[model samples]
Target: MVTIAIIGRPNVGKSTLFNRLVGKRLALVDDRPGVTRDRRSGEASLMDLEFEIIDTAGLEITGAETLEGRMRAQTEIAIAAADCVLFMVDVKVGLTPQDLDFAELCRRTAAKVILVANKAEARGAESGVLDAYSLGLGEPIGISAEHGMGMAELRDALVEALGEEAFADPLAEDEPEWWEEEAPELVAEGDEGEEAEAPPYDDTKPLRIAIVGRPNAGKSTLINRFLGEDRMLTGPEAGITRDSISVEWDWRGRKIRMFDTAGLRRKARIQEKLEKLSVADALRAIKYAEIVVIVFDVTIPFERQDMSIVDLIVREGRAPVIAFNKWDLIEDRQPVLAELREKTERLLPQARGVKAVTVSGETGEGIDRLMKAIVETHEVWNRRISTAKLNQWLSRTIGHHPPPAVAGRRVNIKYMTQVKSRPPTFMISTSRPEALGTSYTRYLINGLRESFGLFGVPIRLGLRKTDNPFAPKRKRPS
Candidate 1:
């Protein structure tokens, strides 16, 4: 599909237009300028026209060394890659000198350009729309990106620029693909096995992974290394990333969709509404992701906030792999890594045996190992043990370390069976479930992790009282 990119000076309602086109609030939008520093892409449709739309950082006129300048560079790159550019102008703000400057730059691009006069709903915006003609980019199409006005006209403009053929409908294809036709059959067959605990994972589906950490943990840098492209904006800046940007990539022929999220600071420190929104976006990414990679600054590894994030990931039931970033900065590697691993087990006992990879997102070190660990952790997260094996393990484990009696009554765990996989939930029928102590439950969880290789993932264990059918009927009397 043809890719169209939206470019304009800061706070020209670029993100609003992007969200309107994409039909989702994928990009971060605020009253402030430069809320968007990195370019975000999504599939968009205008009427019958289905195409890819890119939302880029506002173009700024600043020196190359500054943050605004870096944002400008990203916008330029977006313009270069796009098949068409939507050069947006704030008719409400009436086209600033910066808008004129960027218009010249857009005019020089090889891509097709369409001038968009935004905030056309406001009174006296027509003069600004008329003034946009002096930029020499042709008639400015009036649009209200915020109120959803002039979309039909905008669609007409896109059709005229790219032609109806460029907006090919994906549903036009007659034949159903192999995955659509046969993948469900494969899943059903695997699930029908006598000893099958969980259906085989569909490799054709992309793995959704979210990278999260405290501010300046190099989450974006690590993702850029994985993609082998500067897809994320990175710098010495602590909170450079604002939106949880999801990028599609392939590693070793495995499809991966990675979310680069904003740095999560403590709640007390987050004063601005924008930061709150960023944090919420990051959290949503974590909730939806199958695997979460918690990137840590090696120098400040296992900080309080880092542990909190890990606990959150655990509570979210996401498979986690700890990534110690900036390993190149560490002088003594072996002893440090060993100590870190020990600390990990102690501090994060809730997620015991979780995988930790030493990586340098800057110099591209240990990335291969990181990717391998991610895939392995995902498998472990989706692992299931058959009823026979689970019972056998439980019997052996109980024999070695039986549960202590509560109130002189023995609490007997009769049977256990895995109910589901993704994060591995199990149900146990017990004689006195309420009498089971937390320590004994922990012991059982640890045993399950050790016995079935269910490491690096959250395990859900539930207890239900075993009903005695022979002698447990109570008479209902008045």
Candidate 2:
């Protein structure tokens, strides 16, 4: 993959352009200088071409022992490793001596450099962009990263610099449509029939997964472990991240986009505007995600707030997997794991037996198991049942236990078929849809879970009242 490093002095719109290429606000962008201390890498797309883009800290002169110095060290590493470098300059502020210094540094690194003159939206920007030639970094690609001007030219330069290897998705081809099948019909029991099936999951498409939990539950730390880098800022601070940052990576040959969301706190406790925004952003991520990992600090275990978060995800109809972070901190692993498992089963009955993998986000323990659990749970969430199998099971279940008599009359269940997956929705045609008690629905859901191997994911049962259409027609004919 072609690696492009965005390198420049502070406040040069490097992070802004970084967010643009990645197609989302994954990096924390502020007007304040030095807001980005660590270098961040993401899968970036310039039109059809895709490659890795690294957002590094602004270059500064400081002792190697200083924080800014260490940050520059990180940027240096990125520059050396990069196949090409995007040397950014704030055209609005004009080129400074520091820009020339960084330009010389890039020249010494033996990497192809594309000079980007940012903030070139105004008429005056032309003069500043023209002045960029003094640095001798070749023609500047004038752009306004904030306003998104000149991307077509930027795309051209990137394709030229990175050559044919920097291939973009063709503009001519349309996005592949997700396949849909006709709803299966309720045929006679034991009759062979094709089940209504969801389109096969396009695994090539990145699986959108969100990591969420209470304040400082190691949500960011766990994601950092998965990425094998300190991509997210982590410390003793509870709510350092205010935006839901999505990082795209390939795991075990399958593409996955991981979202590191802000820690969610109780609504009453959210008094600050920033905290409220953070919570809102996190909620948005949950809705967008196909799977959510509800992380827990193993030492603290399950809290009432944590259960509420899980409830929210279930209500949103997203697949959930429970996980414990900081497992290395726990003593007597076997007993602790057993107790956690028991508690998980008892507390979050919404997703019974949801794979509760324990991992040390800081130490990188049990990460593989956590990943496996996520993949398996996602598969189960998308599972569909054949119409014949569904009816056969429903008939047996009704025969054995049966819905309880409602007002001295048995509520008839006429038919059942799967309407959807990705939380596996089913529609049941019944004589008295309202008479089907929550208890009986739960019973059916539990039976479906056990019989069909859908153990942990939420199963949605929609009741549809179907009256005989031909009955009215028969009466009119008479």
Candidate 3:
């Protein structure tokens, strides 16, 4: 697919156009300049054209050491990689010196530049749109990115710039069609006569992983290391990342879609509306991600906010892997590692046996191990136990430590079956479900975790009263 990069000065509606093209609010948008720091991409469709659209940081002229300069470097990189560039300018504000400087940049760098005069719906924007021709980038496409105007003309311009052949689906010729492939056969039973588990997870499917933690926990730093580039805007500053930027890349031939979310701060500390929105985006990432890497600063590991994030992940039923980031910063490795292990088990008992990896985001240490752990944890999260195996285990467990009697009447555990996997959930029928205490449930859950190797991932256990066949059914009033 053709790759198009949107570039311009800050607050020129570059992100707005990106969100419009992607048909979703993937990038963070605000009236404030330079809200977007990192370059984000999404699959976009405009009429018949299908392409990959990149949302870049607003171009600014600054020194290489400055944050704005780093952002500009990313945009320049995007411009180089892109087949076409959409040079957006706020027509309402008219073309400024900054716009002119970037226009010269687009002409010099991008192969095909499309001048997009945004906010065209506003009054007096027509004169500003007309003034855009001074940059010498051909007739400007005047459209309101916020109002979704002039998309058809923009599509035409794109087709004209990059031949229509560029829009053709590359997969048609390069890869086998998904629908043409043979369907997988379902197995009813296993070799030992146990119930058949769900088919193995599709390796071809991209694994969705989200990196989350409190502010300045090295979430973005870790992801940058993974990509082997400064893909995310990272620094010593806390909360530099405000949007849940997702990047799709192959890790050891396995497709991985990793989301770098904003650092989550306590509610009282998040006084600004923008911060609130950023936190909300992070929470959304946690819910959608199949596996979540809760990053921790090695120096201040497992703070109150960190534990709260862990609790949130468990409650959301996401498979979690703990990453002790900034390991290079630690002076004594052995003692810190041992202490972290002890604290992990004691403080995060809910997610008992959670996999923890010590890593340095700055030096790219332990990344391979972390990725391997994530994959393994995902397998465990999606693991399903056969009904026969569950029943056998239940029987032995009950025999060893039966449920305590409720009102002198023993609560009988009847049957157990796995309803689903993906954070494996089970339904248990009992003679007195209400009478069964939380302690017994916890015991059963722990047993399941240990027995099935469901460490770290959340396991759901629900109780239902057994239906008595001998009991007469209530007659319907007809």
Candidate 4:
């Protein structure tokens, strides 16, 4: 895929446009100039084209021999590596000398340039839009990056510049030409399709696990113990992690892909827009993960925000394993563990029977047990129940305590079926879905967790109202 870079003077809405195009807040945006100091890369697809887009720090050459010089050097490096350069300019501010200097730099680089005149929503931007032409670059595409204007033109320009063949829609056509041709006989048709092969399932693929928690909770230290090296930078400072980093390795011959995310803090503390963007990126990593290990500091385990994070993970339908790190620091380990379990159970009642492990990131104590818990949780996450077995369990569960009456009418849960796994989701065909109380839903979810051996995995029980077609339609009295 082509690599595109957005380079411009600071405060030009380049980061805003980057977030908009990437369909996520991968890049930080702030009203303050020079908020973006690093070159952040993200994958973006415009229409039919997919490319890696890098959002670079705004270019400024002040003090020819200082730190500013180093910053300018980084911007130049990003420009050199880009396949196409998006020269962003603030239309409201008009064409400044800094903008012209950057435009001249782009011209010298000879990179394919798409001049974007941002903040075009304001009145009287036409003169500045026209002034952009004097830069000797091609016509400027007037846009309001903040308000999401002129995206189609931008997409068209990118496709045209990147080559139209690269932007062809993959789903526009049906089957490929090869599929229409006659299939060659492989040991004749009556081979029983190689003994009726079972549905393809990959057991060897590396388990994608994400270790997440608040900063200074020994997350980095735990990762070091697991990898047997100081792979991630760990210090006493909070918010040391500024980006989501992934490390791939094997544990007991089982391939694992582990992602270490920046500690998530309350919104008020995350005043810096860059930190906010980093937190959002961490949440994205959580969503993509198959299993999530929520590491918590032993002293402050099950804090309100920590529980909120766990709730977010469960709500996202990902299996969670609670790991209380820094056990070596706890003075009374046994009582503390018991109290921690009780607090976790009370706080996160949604994740009933969830696995919790205690380990010391410093000494590597209980690391093997933690791994075993992860494997068990993963098995539960991928567990499936047969239709008959589910129906059997459903009968017994409802028989024990039937759904309560709503509006003086009995609410009947007619049937239950497993819709999907990887955090099992079940659909219960019912008469009145809206009437089902939260307690009843919890009851069913707990029942599934217990009967189906779905420990430590989030279970979703959906109430789906099924229309009764057998009942005769009431004829209107004429």
lDDT of 1 by residue, 404-442 (tens): 898888888888877767689888889998889888999
What is the lDDT of every predicted structure here? 0.88, 0.84, 0.88, 0.79
Selected candidate, larger TM-score, 2 vs 3: 3
Q: Candidate 2: where is the Cα deviation over 4 Å?
A: 18-74, 94-101, 122-141, 150-208, 227-237, 240-257, 268-285, 404-409, 470-478
Better structure of 3 and 4 per lDDT: 3
lDDT tens readout by residue for model 4, 62-130: 974554454566677778888899999998999889988888899899468999989888899998899
lDDT of 2 by residue, 174-278 (tens): 545222122433334333255444456454545779999998899988988999986676767666566677777789787788888888888989996656766
Q: For this target, which candidate reaches the highest TM-score against the unseen true structure?
A: 3
Candidate 3 lDDT over 1-478, as tens digits, reads 7999999999999999999999999888888998988899988999999899999998888898788888888899999999999999998988889998988898888899999999999988889988999999999999889999999989999998999999997565656533222332332322324566557766565688999998898898899899988789887778788889988788878778889999998888989888888999999898878899999999998889999999899999899999999999898789888999999999998889899999999899999999989988988987878788999999999999999997799999988888777778888889999999999999999999888788888999999898899999999999
- Cα lDDT, model 4, residue 250: 92
The per-residue C-alpha lDDT of model 4 at residue 222 equals 92
Residue pair clashes in candidate 3: none
Q: In candidate 3, where is summed lDDT lowest over 10 consecutive residues?
A: 178-187
In the order shown, the candidates' Cα RMSDs to the true structure are 3.8, 5.2, 3.5, 9.3
The number of residue pairs in model 2 that clash at the backbone is 4
**Alpha carbon deviation, residue 147, candidate 3 (Å):** 1.0
Total clashing pairs for each candidate: 0, 4, 0, 0
